[model samples]
Target: MDVISAVGAAIRTAFDMFWDVLWPLVLGFGLSGIVQALVSHKTMAKLLGDDSPRSLSLATLFGVASSSCSYAAVALARSIFRKGASFVSAMVFEIASTNLVIELGVILIVLLGWQFAASEFLGGIVMVILLALIFRVTLTPRLVSLAREHAERDAVGRMEGHATMDMSVQGGSFLSRLLSGRGFTSISHLFVMDWASVWVDVAGGFLIAGALAAWVPESFWQHLFLSGNPTLAKIEGPLVGPLVAIISFVCSVGNVPLAAVLWRGGISFGGVVSFIFADLIVLPVLDIYRRYYGGRVMLYIFATFYVTMAAAGYIVEIVFGALGIIPSNRAVGIITHGPSWNYTSILNIVALVVAAILLVRFLRTGGPAMLRMMSKPETSGEHDHQAIAMDRSIP
Candidate 1:
């Protein structure tokens, strides 16, 4: 291909990937916003106050209803930890928030397939359990104390207010509030905040997938993944999956598209799962974790997360093999011709309209000001943990 054609191909590939998953993103985040509006953060903190099975389970459930942005999850996890939630429970919440989120799963289904999405849910639970175990064994009181001190220092996570705000509509029944004006405002804030939190990751995933698909020779990925030997591929894929994510500059729901590209490139099924599970461990996120919880806690979080993610991947490989569902076809190709007239295109058009409506609602609700504060640490995080109004439902 000529230089112009090559560039055009890359751009088209990226757009195609974006168009394919655009509707799913809208649907997932919109629903997540609704969930958040119904749930209260104070309730979350109260229920997750201890590290018992009950607390951990509630934390996971709360996280599934909360924001799916990895940064926001980290920020929120810190918020609860500072509020007396156990360190292990908070860590479990962080994992569930990012991995078991609706948008992440929807995007996975759209891009890769149902099987990959299934693996995500299954592996996510396994990863969380392993993470909890690791933290219980290695996380000591002194380390927790140091981490608490660092959180009190308020080093300013990127989406502090986005994570900290409790905009759930007050008064009225569930349906009434969901249909109220304040409810719309809450949803808009959540929807916009969710987008702002992960736009970079999503766009980065698209661009990286495009570049990788257009430039990297299949032989390189195949040889690197040990695709010629099935057994070696299974072992190496899980091991290298997180390394790919660490360097990919993409995480959260954003990683799904690139995961698609990697799946097509010759990675094993378990390798794909491991890659998606590593979003929070990416370099930028690791820095964010360091800021939120201090270096010692960050190191433990990294070590535990990486080991659990890899183990989950291997377990998925064995389980899927037993179930006779491991896919042999890895020949899916990226779209380079722009969006064709199809159901996905129609859905994209409809989704764009929904997104536009939400954006308008957000701006009118002082979302721009909220965003300004959220983006800058000086403004939004001046006192990140300076206790919000103590209001919660003790479930």
Candidate 2:
């Protein structure tokens, strides 16, 4: 009975955390879908063909406009890279897509507070810049060629269909494209697709977080995070944060809930930020990288990502600490409070209605067929043809 009760408690905790962020997730994904509907993948590929500062900037912008699912983002990065985007630009895009997207920022603000949101966005840019510099110095012509060769071989990775699908409404003003029947269909499809891609990671993250919160003792976390030594904790936090994330096997915005658990358990502010940023380097992703870019490139990516993630954490920790914006109180409400009548609840209700409407539109518009293709390996032409057919069916 005790064991069952413990399991129930953990599940309940996870559900509460999900409820708290439901509205923000809906709002973020909805906005992301709208942006994906408006922006052409081909255009993004054309703009990111080189690793110039201009190209990198455009990659960041386009990435922010893309899906927040880490797997989708990684898959799309490979797709763009294969389509002529520079390796550096492609990686930067992947980072921004997962870390700097609307959904991630909104969820961070809702759960961890504005400081974390600010740190994530600001640190994300810092990490990107750091990664770009590292790649410039370390990435060689031969390495790039090798990676491209492997990518062109089209080794199947998670979300291959999603990566190749180009559902953007073409040839119209932004508002016209957004409000058009095709635009609505495009948005609904992308929204549902994005949700389908990362729901597992999100659910897993919540359950792991809930279990950790319910089953683990506070002292254990404090010891693991080195809470007893202030100076050392700050230094160690950034160093160890990514390692924790790597093992957790959670990626995308899903890791945010676990981050909250860590924060309350006495991880330094920077540690939490680094943990969030380290989703790309999770174990499963590393294996995907190996398949996509070969073993050597995978190791290179993992090394570079880890160093930059930790550096970004350290930088944010110092800057935010100096500015006194790092939240001292770790008692975040989402971790402690169950579902209650509040603004969060009200927003969740409205958000669910909006989501239901979109889901209905998605189901009516052949979304299941598209979803079935989400993990399949396909040629770019096939993806394009299917996208066009789906759009035509809507009208």
Candidate 3:
């Protein structure tokens, strides 16, 4: 009976997460697709020029306007990095796309309340600034050379094509087209691509949340990292939560529900925030980074991001506490009853259909095929041996 009840509860939680996040994700994805269509790669390259002080800001805006998938972000960052974006700026883009996007902000506002939502944006900016400052102080020529060599190898010694808007005008002036450039077909395609990008994360997060709701023993979490002090307890959450996130292998916004579960399980506020922030350091991305930059570069990236997240999480907890905004309980239940035939269920079905149509459109359009053509194995130059050495060292 207890087991059956748990299973039922999990299903309800998953359904509720799906219901709350699906529409906002669709809107976010569309906005990203339109932005991608409009922004030229040359423009991005110029904005991210080595000497541009505004490079980080431009990177942040581009990231918020681009796709939210961590894997996709990695590919896009690599593409821009090849075109002269600084490593720091590219990292900032990755962070922004993951944390500061429209869908994420909307979901946070809806699920966790406006304060947590605001903290996410504030925390993202802080993370970006820290990354830029870290780069200024710790960047080594060897690291830069390695990244460039790997990027060139990945491109097979050629630059990848930029994402450009496909506007067909019948001999009209630039301004004439700019004001009314898109037809019905273009608008539909934009919505389709946007929905597809966000749908995967939403569904994945639901599935994971369901599993956690059903199977994770609640008692185990209450004692994992008790140090008898709130600040110390909070500080420790970031460290352990990220380790768990890395091992879980679900990147992007898919990690949110799990973070919520941790918050419910007595993990500190800073810890939950850190777990959410540490998505970039997860296994799939780390493996790709290793493939792209060899072990040394990967290690540096891991250390840099991990330390920065720890600090950010602690700072957020302190700020929120001082401001008297820290919630007494992080897990305010969203779904009280089991799934049934209702408005939310109807909407869930609709979201599923919408997701499927968008997915089909995305594959049929140029995006998926283009990404496939672009994903080539990079050679690790001098770091090839270092990669091997590092793997052995990872006990």
Best by TM-score: 2
Predictions in order: lDDT = 0.83, 0.90, 0.65
- The candidate with the higher lDDT, 1 or 3, is 1
Q: What is candidate 3's lDDT per residue for 245-284, written digit by digit as tens? A: 8887777777876666677777887787888888798886
For model 1, the superposed segments whose C-alpha errors exceed 4 Å read 333-338, 376-395
RMSD value for candidate 3? 9.2
lDDT of 3 at 225: 51
Across 1-395, the per-residue lDDT of candidate 1 in tens digits comes to 88898887777788888888899999999999999888878777778888888998888898899888888888888888888888888889988998888998888777777888899999989987888787778888999888889887778767777777776766779999888777787788789888998898889889888878887788898888998998999989999999999998787788887887788889999999999999889998899889877898888888889999999999999999999998776755434345678998899899999999989877766676666655554334433211221111111
Estimate the TM-score of every prediction: 0.93, 0.97, 0.79
Model 2 / residue 97 / CA error / Å:
0.7
Question: How far is 32's C-alpha from truth in model 3 (Å)?
Answer: 3.1
Q: Would you give me the overall lDDT of model 3?
A: 0.65
Candidate 3: misplaced stretches above 4 Å?
1-9, 155-187, 194-201, 225-229, 335-395
Off by over 4 Å in 2: 385-395
